[model samples]
Target: MSAGTIALTNNSATVSGTGTVFTTDLKANDFIVVIVGGVTYTLGVKATASATSLTLITPYGGPTATGNAWTAVPNATLVGITAQVAADVAKAIRGLNLDKANWQQVFSGTGTITVTLPDGSTYSGPAWNSLTTLLNNKAAKGANSDITSISGLTTALTIEQGGTGAKTAAAARAALGAFSTAGGAVSGSITAGAAAGIAVAAGENNRVEINNVTSGVGAGNPVGWTVYRWYTELAQTGIRRAGDTTIQSYFVALSGGGGWEFLRGGNATASGTWTSGSDIRHKFDIEKVKNALASVLTFNGSIYGKKDGGREVGLIAQDVERACKEAITYNGDRKFSDGTVIPNFKYLNTAGAAAAYHTEAIKTLFELVELALDKPDDARALIASIKEQSEVIKNTPIENEDPRKEAPPIFDVPSSEDYEEPTT
Candidate 1:
């Protein structure tokens, strides 16, 4: 709305070109007259231009012919095309009306688009070229479907990849060392010729435990076989026998067969040329071997007791070996009777002291001294008491007894380490 004017004439004589021209600068709300073919009309000018040929526009809702409908000003915006322009024909012809789409219509694309309605909220859609319009139209209720808008999708999209769900949480836990099933098939590689010791619980299935156990490192894993094989080898080698090789391999093979062999090694009397190439027999089987060697070392002997000649052996007395063998036989050592190897000795020696003699008599003497020393009284007191008691019993007369019978004499007490046998 400003000041200026344009003149228009149908005849060439009145106007410069056959259009409108203005005689003077017209302020806003100015009016002009035009006569064409003897018909005079008044035109309300809304805007004026200063070009050689003036241009003017008619303001909206200014005036119109009595029978003709008013056309909207060119390029003019209206509020809520749906409600404002209720006529169907007017809305249909309107360009770029967003409500041209229904409530369920969704526009999707890239870039920016501004949507202006006649009277409703102002929204933005993408520009014509930058964005794509995805209009989702859903029915009343045949299926529950509605159009929803998704934002923040990038321009370049690859649809082939699917979501990898919950991977972050899976990576947070600790790893396990070994896995096995109670009864499932398993396979793995074992080193050849690597020795390993194995212990299988008794009463388990009596079958070959490991696969390919011969001559391989796996020979070490026969579940209680090492003792027999190792000792057999040591025994044969210690005696410098040719059978040592056979003994070693035999024990290795026999381990799975539940065989155990016990052997002792040391210099002994040569039995028949002391055959350097002969194999000696080990005294135990697998089961017994496990028990005996459970505590004894093949080379070192008993763990708790001293070496073979130590106190638990025959070191305490020179005659202990003879005594042990005799006692063993006297008690029917051939076969256990009442689970005893030797009969308990309790009687008199030839000198008639309350005594029991061992085949190795020194052992009996040591036992007697040990028993005496184990008593509460001092050694001197005990010895003195024994002497006094001996005299009393020796001198006392037996009532109603023949005087021709001689009294029994007490044998001299044996010393623990050094003792002299009484002379007749």
Candidate 2:
């Protein structure tokens, strides 16, 4: 609040001031009025303020004098008015009787405002209702209601908003390495193990080994195999072994029951290949395949050049193959030829081969049929013969008995007339 008096130094360019003046009290490009030898001179620029002494851009043109008053000229517009004058003006505006007719003469224009006074007090302008409505629409927080702690803020602060606080604009950035200044190249490598490996870069061949990875192991099993342990053994693109260009990649694995098997990689031209391993054993159930074939094959006596007695003819080799293709369920390795992959039943391939294999296959099929048809009749005949033999044994007489003699009755029955009437 005090406008200090200037004490001119021996040098006309430098002058000292009294009463709470410091280097921060003035800034560059500020207009200052100084009184020297009862003559007032306005300085265009205030170069610096240092501990009550001021160095000016242009020196005073009069004799060096002590106790000369110096005052900083205020800016023209009130938009950026100093906090000191703003507080005083706000106080004066609040003290005015705004409802009086003279107050209307004081204000040339009509506008609403919520005047915040110097003593932390507030006054509503002429349009109190509209001012409050506008203030409500502004969504401005109260002075104390505004956030005090920044712990909840997640966004980076701006330079005007106190910045990151770790570095300054004037600080050298060489410690960060490789920073350019005005198109000049600044180059450096971040070497590893220099400062406890904190800024170390990973090497080209450096690998992070994940130890003891047993993702799919059973309980109490050894922890050595990773989820991709099988994949790591094979090359990603081509074959690994020498002189093996056709075989792209492969992996070998042990079964839970201690059996080993080879797994072939997929053909990119075709669909993927099945996984290789002893645990991947998936065979067509022989019994199930036989049952499925038997259910479709039938013996039609009229089809094979016989009206009454003919060989089984309903199921030809082609029909059996078609039925096998439709019915058979298998997950084993298949021989694929430029066609749809199907359950490979080698016996059902051709008529000649089928007939050859059918002879063997029908041996079992005929056994099933003969057991179903002829065995029941044979069993019935055996049962009938046993019954006849049992009847003959009952009709035939004993070896020591006479042929003409009659057997004695077991007991005699009395006549109805000889029987006396019994009491009721």
Candidate 3:
């Protein structure tokens, strides 16, 4: 390492250094590492220009920069190996990488590939290029046609014989696209250990699959699936499943709410309507809903504001949890960025559980309705008495009433928008 600060003009072959000793540390073919903007660039030193500067055989093509830190490193020394042997070792390592990643080159023109066996024998075929292609052409793994003679192997096999039925490799690849009846990808498939994924053109369908034998199922996650739908103008939505869908473990993001939270679902659809499985075959011990009347009374249907600056007419989860614990769902505690922690809740409004905690309340209300229905004669006598009492009050004039405002009692539901305050 020599210089403190350096300057290199774009397209110039000179490297000027400040407070540097280039002639003492670098020589003709040695390389100098200059770090500019956090990126290191290695330039070959053509010759030692002077103590304060060194010449580059190739000019600096990067942006012109000054005050860069640099270091000098001579050509790497090879120990116990020639340059040819090092090149061969690199080639062999690259071949292994290509094999593990299922990488291949597609060529339309004619070419030859020589295969060197471990026995120090090399063979090259005029028609076949790779060993895989050559062996696939000659061998019959399934019930297919066979080539009995060497002259018969000149032409490619037919489709019935598991071959592409085309002579050239590119043509064979194109022909293989027509056959899609398989468990694996036939045309454009990238195997496991692929670093960079294969590219897909427009109008092509991109599939993200997890196979059983490949990198699919793993420990802790026996069956896991997630479906994503991207949106350009709005936030994306998705459906995810942790276990099988026969139970209530499926989840789906219905819409963007406070935080676009996912709602748990089951075999029932998460759209609008929901269904409860009431089949006797699937049920263990079933009974009628009791204490529904008590729950209805306990339900404090008051107007409340939501966290999203909107008002809603519903029961608070914490309040209802006290009254009806079944209606309230606990999904663990939620910690906010401001260090505020609160227990999260999920309200299953339509679930039978939403009406839990007291079935006797509902049963009491049901008995009242049944009583009103059963005793019709007694109800008629009570109604006749009420009519007579109402007539007596209407015949008499009230002290503080307006004389013109005389009418029978009228019962109707009033809309809040239409209701107005009464004048004194």
Candidate 4:
């Protein structure tokens, strides 16, 4: 609006001004707005503006007045607004910050929204107010995939479910280092009471360790640990695969003279023969047995209860050692009930040591029966030979005339005494 003071006339179209530069500040067809007699009038300019005088389009509308305050403005189509039932929004903000009045007005459907911009410019469809909302939603955690990392969560996701299963920051960071078996890595459990960890090694040469942890402290504290392991091999120790040359998995310990041992829960009942290596090529100094019957008699087998809840008839190791020292073996690994070390456990060779003596005795018994079976045939042959010799003697009787002498000489020699062991 142009700054001015103007004089008005009562019921006249002529209007005059004092100190108002109408030519420089006011123009034709603009409205002259003024208040007179406590009433206001907006008059249209009828002619060109001059330095001191102008004419209204019609007669003065308000009561007659001399000098009055007025403002001149360019003419436009909209003149006034009239509304009778406009509801007043009680919660409407009285004032707005032009810098922050970005109401991201969104409409769901497709329609043109003509906005009169702050600068009085117009657009059919506006794509603004959006920078702020877009910026805000971009930084939000669950708003979109743009959020790369998040924090301050009350729940944790498990590793098997493709998340780091931890509630704390440190635990989450550590769990991220673990892997899955589907990744071609070995996964197994080795745990303490409530704590757990895993060690992953890369290659076969990388040794997996079973660490002996510190012992517990208390009156009845635990002392040691027992490890149970399984393998792919069905056989143990020195045995080879049934149809392959590879040796079976072995359980080797420093004791038992470093020999491999097979351990189990109960007795082994086999469906096929179990043969021990007895090739003479693997042995030496073979010899025939003598006095096997005497050796068999020396073995004193007795029925006794085993310490492990069973009844057995077996020779005592000490008693057998007295007769044959080779039949006994002292165990190198033994301890007392109180953990005191000792190694006097004499384990006997019950399966193999004295078998040779019994076997030799059986062979000798078979040989005697065969000799008795051939004795009758030999006696018959001898009788036939004596008859032939008598016939020859009769044919030669004339030459010797010794029938009476020969008959006298026909007396028999006695049989030999029973066989006995020769004196040394």
RMSD of each: 30.2, 37.4, 28.1, 33.8
Q: For this target, which candidate reaches the highest lDDT against the unseen true structure?
A: 3
The numbered model that scores best in TM-score is 4
After superposing candidate 3 on the true structure, give the runs of residues whose Cα lies further than 4 Å from its correct spot: 1-206, 209-276, 337-339, 344-350, 353-366, 369-424
Residue range 200-271, candidate 3, lDDT tens digits: 222234333332221233322323233232332222223333444422233344225212324332123344
Who is ahead in TM-score, 2 or 4?
4
RMSD of 2: 37.4
If ranked by lDDT, best first, what sequence of candidates would result? 3, 4, 2, 1
lDDT agreement with native, every candidate: 0.32, 0.44, 0.54, 0.52
Alpha-carbon lDDT of model 3? 0.54
By summed lDDT, the worst window of 10 consecutive residues in model 3 runs over 397-406
Q: Which stretch of 10 consecutive residues in model 4 shows the poorest summed lDDT?
A: 398-407
Across 7-77, the per-residue lDDT of candidate 4 in tens digits comes to: 77778888887878777656777777787777777788887558888888898867767667787766653
- Compose the digit string of candidate 2's lDDT tens values, residues 52-108: 776777776677678876777543422256566888887677655433433443354
* Model 4 / residue 207 / CA error / Å: 24
Model 1: ten consecutive residues of lowest lDDT: 288-297
lDDT of 4: 0.52
Candidate 1: tens digits of C-alpha lDDT, residues 337-406: 1232222322212111102232223443354588667863554564565455444433444222112323
- C-alpha TM-scores of all predictions: 0.15, 0.17, 0.26, 0.29
Q: How many clashing residue pairs, candidate 4?
A: 0
Task: Give candidate 1 misplaced runs (Cα > 4 Å).
Answer: 1-114, 117-121, 126-424
lDDT (C-alpha) at residue 207 in model 2: 28
Query: Model 2 compared with the native: what TM-score?
Result: 0.17
